[model samples]
Target: MTTRELPMTVPSEGLPARVRIHEVGPRDGLQNEKGTVPTAVKAEFVRRLAAAGLTTIEATSFVHPEWVPQLADAEQLFPLVAGLPVALPVLVPNERGLDRALSLGASRIAVFASATESFAKANLNRTVDEALAMFEPVVARARAAGAHVRGYLSMCFGDPWEGPVPVPQVVRVCKALTDMGCDELSLGDTIGVATPGHVGALLTALAGAGVPAPVIGVHFHDTYGQALANTYAALQHGVTTVDASAGGLGGCPYARSATGNLATEDLVWMLRGLGIDSGVDLGRLTATSVWMAGQLGRPSPSRTVRALSQQQEQ
Candidate 1:
C-alpha cells in the first residue's frame, strides 16, 4: 500500500498560533538516572531552563521516596525554584503527594494515568479505574487549595507490555481527568511507537469526543526516532502545548529500549525552521543542553546537537 503524503505546513487555524513548551528535564529527566542529582544542581538546571525562555517546567514529583528516591528533595527543590518567573509544575501520584506539593507551595501539579491496564498496574500499582479514583481527590484537593492541575495520560500510542493500545481507552482516561478538573491533559507517546498517522487519528478522535484542543498537549518519546514527525502531526491537529525534555534526558525505566523525550533543542529547531515562534533562544538552549549532558556524564542524544557539534568540530 502506498502511503499518502500530507503537507507539513503549520495550519493557521488548526495549529494554535503560539504554543507553550514545558521543560521536564530537571524532574522527569533526572528522575530516571542512577545517581541522585544534587538539589543545588537541580535548582540551577531549572533556573537555566527558565532563562532560556521556558515558561512552564515540571519541577519534581511529590511521590513517596520509596518510589522515586531521586525526587526526595521535592520540598526543597520546589521552594528553591520559587524565585523563578516561570511556572513550576510538580507531579503528584495521589492525595499524599498532593499534600506534600501543597505544603511546598506548588501552584501547579500534574497527575498521570495509563491507557493500558497492564502498564497502569505495573507503573502505578493500580488498575486504570483505581488510579483515576485515586487522582480524583488529589484533583479536588488541588483545586480547593487554589492550585491548577494538569493530567498526563501515558502509553497512549503503544505499551511495552501491551501493543497497540485502543484509542477509546485513551479518550476515556482523558475525559475522566478533564471531568475531575484537570486544567490540561498531556497525551504521552510513552514508548515512542507512534507515527504521524497515529497522532493525527488520535487527535481527530479526541476532537470528536468533545475534548477541546486547547486543553490537550502532546508528549512524544524518541525511542523509534519518530517523535518529531508525530509532534508535527499533533500540531496540525491544533495542539498548543507540548512536553519535552532538554537534551533528551528522560526515558521510561519500565519500557526496555525506550529512548528519552523529544529533545527541547530539536523541537525548537523544527519549530523555528517552520516559522513557528516558540520564543526560545536556540544558542542559549543548546548551551544549557551541553551543560546538562556534562552533568549527566553522557554525550547528548539529540541529533541536532550531534550535527551542530560535528560542524563546530570541523
Candidate 2:
C-alpha cells in the first residue's frame, strides 16, 4: 500500500492573518499521562518548546498533589525553568495554589472554570455558582498582585452527562471571568464534540453578548476529529489566541471520552500555509514533539508529527 500526499493549502480568505498558539503540552499535556515524567524531562520539554519559537508556554499547574499527582512537583519543577524567554503561565486553582505560584515569582496564572453545571460538579466538586464564587477572589488577587490572569472555561461545547451546551451559558461564564479582570479567556471544547457550526455560533453569540472576541481563545480536543475545523471557524470569527498541546497531548479527565487538545504542529501547518505568522518553526516543533513522544515511550498522536517524521526519514 502507498500513501498519497496532498499539498496542504490554507483557505485564501476569512481567517485571521496571525494566530497566537498557547502551548499546553508541558502542563496540561504531561499531567494526564499515566507515567510519572521525571522533573528533568519535564523541564527539558518546556525548554525545547520555547526553543521551537512558541511565545507562550503553559509551564505547569499548581493544583493539589492529591488531586493531580502527576504535577505534584509543581513547586520544585517551576524553579528549574523560571526565566525562560517566553511567557510561562501556571494554573492556580485557589488562594493556596495562587500563593504557591506567586511565591515562585509566577507573573502569569490561569484559573479553570466549567461552562456546564455537570462538569463543574464533577471536576471541582462544586455547583457552577459555587465554583465561580471561589475563583472570584483568586482572579481578583492575581490581577491586583500584578499578575496576568488567564481564565479557562471547560465543557464549553458539550457535556457527557448533559447533552449539547447552550452558547449563552458559555458566554455568561466568559463574561464573569472578563468582569473579574481576566486578561484572556480560553473556551475549551472539553469533549471534542463541537463542529464548525457550533464554534461559529458560540463565537458569534459571545461577540453579541459584549464579550471581547479578540481576547477569547479556543481550546479543543480531537475526540471527534473536528478540532482543527472548529479552530478554523474560531479564526474566521476573529479569535487570535489558540490553546494547543504539543504533539496533541492532554484531555479533560472528567469529560468522558475526551481526547487530546488540538496539536500545535497541526495548527502551525494551517497557519503557515495561509501565510499567517505563528512564530513557530515547523521542523523544529515537529522534532521537539517527536523527541518528547520518545521520552514517553509512545508515538506522537499528532498527524502532523507522524507525517513530518516519516517525511524526514525519507
Candidate 3:
C-alpha cells in the first residue's frame, strides 16, 4: 500500500480489536441532497461501497416521497443491489414504510427517532413518546418478519432549539427502543454538538439503564469537529459499531444546523492507526469517495479522502 493509503499501526489499550462500520452514505448521506441522484448511480454507489468492504450498508429509506425525494426511488433501487453479499438495511419510518421494505425482501430495517421533543416535533411532526408509539408496531412487525431492526435516536447530545440535552433524557428513549425489540440502537449526534465527555456520559448512562455496550452504536456529525473524539470515547466504552457516511455526504434535513456525518474514510484511517480492524481497504474506499464526489459534482469533504487523493495526484 502507498504511504498515503495506510496509517501506522499503534494499537490503543482498552479498545475493541475490530469495529463494525455501519456505512450510511447511501441512505443518510443522500437523503439531504437538493437534487435527486439517478437510481442507477445510487445502485453503483452501493455496489462500490460493498466492494470497498463495507459489510453493513444502509441501502435506502422507504420514507414517503414527500419527505425524502432523493430516495423516492427506494423501490427501484433496492432490488438492483439486493444480491450483494452484504447486509442491506433500509430505513422504515412506519408500518407502511416497513411493509414497503419487507415487500422488497429487505432483511434489515431501521426506524428513526429523536431524544428531544423539539426535534421530534420538527422531524416527525409528533412528540417523542408519540413517535416511539408509532415505531413500536413497526419494530414488532419487523422483528416478527425476522428482519434485524435498528433504532436511530437523533439529537442525543444537543438540539438546535433545545440546547444541551440531558443524559437521562437520551437514556429513556434508548430504553424504549430496546424494550420495543430493536436489535440495536444507534445514538446520533445529529447536530454535531457532542463532546467526548458527553459521549462517555451518555454511554455510561445507557449502560446503567441496562443498555449493553455491544448493542449500542455511535453516529456523530462533524459540525464542531468532534466526531472522531466522540467516537473514540464510545470505543473506550466498548462500542464496536460506528455509523459513518462515505465522503462525508450527509446532514439532517430536519435540523438545518446539523452538518455532515463522520466520514467513513476518516473513521477507517483512525481504526487503522489505532491497530483496530475495520476490514475496509483505504485505497479503494478513497477512490470510491472520489468517484462519488464526481457524481455529486463536488469534491469530497473527508479530510482523509482529500489528503490521500492529493498524495496520489502528486
Best by TM-score: 3
* Candidate 2: regions farther than 4 A off: 1-11
- Across 1-314, the per-residue lDDT of candidate 2 in tens digits comes to 12233234555687777888999999989989887899999999999999999999999999999888899999989999997888999999999999999999999999999998888998899988899999999999999999999999998989999989988888899898898889999999888999999999998888888886788999999998999899888888899999999999898667658989899999998887677788898888888999999999999999988997887678
What TM-score, computed on C-alpha atoms, does each candidate reach? Answer: 0.94, 0.96, 0.99
Q: Which digits, one per residue and each the tens of the lDDT, describe model 1 over residues 50-84?
A: 89899998999998888889888988888888879
Would you give me the overall lDDT of model 3? Answer: 0.95
Tens-place lDDT per residue, model 3, 57-127, is 99999999999999999999999999999999999999999999999999999999999999999989999
Best by lDDT: 3
Once superposed on the true structure, which residue ranges of model 1 sit more than 4 Å away at CA?
1-14
Q: Relative to the true structure, how large is the alpha-carbon lDDT of every model?
A: 0.86, 0.89, 0.95
TM-score-better candidate, 2 vs 3: 3
TM-score of 3: 0.99
Q: Which ten residues in a row have the lowest lDDT in candidate 3?
A: 1-10
Residue 24 alpha-carbon offset, candidate 3, angstroms: 0.3
Considering lDDT, which of the candidate structures 1 and 3 is the better prediction for this target?
3
Clashes of each: 0, 0, 0
